[model samples]
Target: MKLIIAVVQDRDSNRLSQALVWEHIPVTKLASTGGFLRAGNTTFLIGVDDDRVEKVLEIIRKNSQVRKGWMTPHMGGGNEGDGSYPVEVQVGGATVFVLSVERFEHF
Candidate 1:
């Protein structure tokens, strides 16, 4: 068995989840936050047979999109009137990890 952990941006979460459901793939969704951007994210826990891992990954790739966004970074050790500028950064992509599961049981 394989465990697929997909951390996707909130903007793409709903669409991705729906697509997975449409494909008859069972997924557990969790609300999460990103450390760097402090933005909202959704984590998907998908357990599937080893043979189906590639299909699951393909679904994730098709659903999750990469986009650009602006972020204002905080300046450290600055004066009272220090100003922060918005920087363009790439976002809206899934970080996925596939792990081998020793055992899986459902009640």
Candidate 2:
């Protein structure tokens, strides 16, 4: 068994969930927040057979996407009125972790 942890942006969560369900992959979804942007994120916990790991990863890769956004970054001890500029940033991607499970049980 393997444990797949996928942290995706909220924008992609619905689409990813639907794709996973279509592939008959069971997932446990949790609401989470991203550290960098402090934006909403969704965490998916999926337990699957070892051979199915690649399939699950492929699904996540296909659904989660990276795009650009404008952000006003806080500068040197100043407020938003302190001449802040909008910086283009990359967002909307998934952070995935795959681990080998020693055992798995369901009741």
Candidate 3:
């Protein structure tokens, strides 16, 4: 068996859940906090047979996305990357993990 761990943005948690359910994939969801950005996140725990690993990975890949931070020119024709140092807020993305499950049990 394999344990699939998907960490996704809180904004798209509901959508991801619905899609997984549509594929008949069972998941255990947990609300979590992002480490770098301190934003909310959703963690998904899914246990499936070994053969289904690829399918589960595909689902996560389709949903969890990497976002880019756009920088622009500031006053005095200085680029954002210039050492002028403008204070702006930005959030980091999500992470995912998968591991082999030796055993899983339920009451």
Q: Please provide, for model 1 over 1-107, each residue's C-alpha lDDT reduced to its tens digit, 9 standing for 90 to 100.
A: 99999999898899999999998999999999999884899999999999999999999998886777788776454564667777898767889999999999999
Residue 9, model 2: lDDT of 91
Clashing pairs in 1: none
Q: What ranking of all candidate models by TM-score puts the best one first?
A: 2, 1, 3
**Clash number for each model:** 0, 0, 0
User: 15-36 in candidate 2: lDDT tens per residue?
Assistant: 9999999999999999999888
lDDT of 3 by residue, 54-107 (tens): 987777777656555445336468555576644453433457777989988877
For lDDT, candidate 1 versus 3, the one ahead is 1
Candidate 3 wrong stretches, greater than 4 Å: 67-93
Q: What TM-score goes with each of the models?
A: 0.76, 0.77, 0.71
User: Cα deviation in Å at residue 15, candidate 2?
Assistant: 0.5
On lDDT, who's better, 2 or 3? Answer: 2
Lowest lDDT block of 10, candidate 3 = 85-94
Candidate 1 lDDT: 0.90
After superposition on all CA atoms, what RMSD does each candidate show versus the true structure?
A: 5.4, 4.8, 6.2
